[model samples]
Target: MKIKQYRTQFIQELSPLYDAYEAESFFYLILEEKHNLRQIDVALNHELIFSESEIWVWNSLLAELKKEVPIQYLMGKTNFYGLDFEVNEDVLIPRPETEELVEWIINENLKAQKFKKLKILDIGTGSGCIAISLAKNIPNARVFALDVSKEALKTAKKNSENNKVDVTFIHQSILEIDDLKNDFDIIVSNPPYVRNLEKKEIKNNVLNYEPHLALFVEDTDALIFYRKIAEIAQKNLTENGQLFFEINQYLGEDMKALLEEMNFKNIELKKDIYGNDRMIFCNVSKTS
Candidate 1:
């Protein structure tokens, strides 16, 4: 079949689940992943035909897409902060908002006049996207990432190597760590901030396929991970160190209050491109 013919059928089949634009995007994503064909390539070679074996591969992915499996998972890799990251069921897919958070960190550091090397820790690093991105962008940074799941850490380590950046990976839960055993100029986390009650608001694709352990918290105590990580940061952050979080949009006020109660000064809440309150930054005082 000609590529355009298959593209039409592919988008039509998934239109019931995703919008026309999203479906078209998925088509190009799979084309690139499965056939090394970009949208421009397919357009230029409109007669490009899919052999029987290639059709089989595309059909298999189409079936999974109908099942609401994430395209990133289907591709087994994603681009974040201009770096390629290997992803799986063990890790939450890195989002664009998280990339914004990373850009914020890099921009802040770049604005500083000091030439001293800075230390950074990414709590619950998951796929190590943030740590690896920071290390790759900031040549003077020493980056470390921690996760409770050894499986996630394994994927993170591979990503660090694949990205050609050195990031120290620690397989430990942030909830259990009292001190990081070292002070960091920056500590950041995008922990399990979603309350169980918010499950209804989440899409079926994410709710059903993404790992629950990395996505949820008790409804009654939704800020458990944030509070725990903040507590650790209190002791582990160097004087004037910054703490950053990619937060739950609904809990922006709550997050600010928590940081204030913890004596995190200069607390700032920022919105993402979608205008959602999705990231926060705080600084520790030298005396406190």
Candidate 2:
């Protein structure tokens, strides 16, 4: 059948699960991945058709999409911070809000007049998106990433290599580590801040498919990772070194209070494009 006709049917079948815009986006993404045809190419070539085998492949993918599998996982890759990353069930798919956090780090460090080599650490570095992006953007940065999952580290290591950035990957749980070992000029984490109670707020694509170990915490101790990372940061951060986090929106005040109790100075809570309290920044106090 003509590819355009199939595209219409694809959207119609998926309409019950996904909005038209999202479904159409998925179609183009698959078209580019499987057929190497851009949207413009499809529009221009009215005679283009899918072979029987191609239709079978598309249909199989459609069934999975209806099951609410993330498109990034379906494609086995995603784009973050202008870099392409390999993704799978093992790693949490990088999100746009995390891009903002990376941009903030890059921008702040870029403004410094002293261009010295800086050591950076990314705790809970799923997919190595934040660490790799920092290494790519901040030329003077030596980046290290740590994660608890061996499977997640495997995906993260491949992504660093694919992105052509040299990031040291550590397969250790931050919660259990006594010390970070090296003093870092910047320390950042987007740890498991989503609490168990917040599961109802999550979409099926995330709640069902994304790795829960990287996405959630007990409702009673939602700040467990944050508190642990901050304690380590206090010991490991260089004087005036910065700390950053992508936090759960509902717990902004809780995060602020945690940082304050840790004696973090110059604390700043920032919102994402959606105006959710999604990021926080602070520095280790000189007295601490």
Candidate with top lDDT is 2
Local error of candidate 1 at residue 52 (angstroms):
1.0
* Model 1 lDDT per residue over 160-263, tens place: 99999899999898887888789999998999989888999999999989889999999999999999988988898998899999999999999999999888
How far out, in Å, is residue 220 in model 2? 0.6
lDDT on C-alpha atoms for all candidate structures: 0.93, 0.94
Q: How accurate is candidate 2 locally (lDDT)?
A: 0.94
- Return the top candidate by TM-score: 2
What TM-score do all the candidates reach, one by one? 0.98, 0.98
- Cα error, candidate 2, residue 240 (Å): 0.4
Task: Rate residue 89 of model 2 by lDDT.
Answer: 96
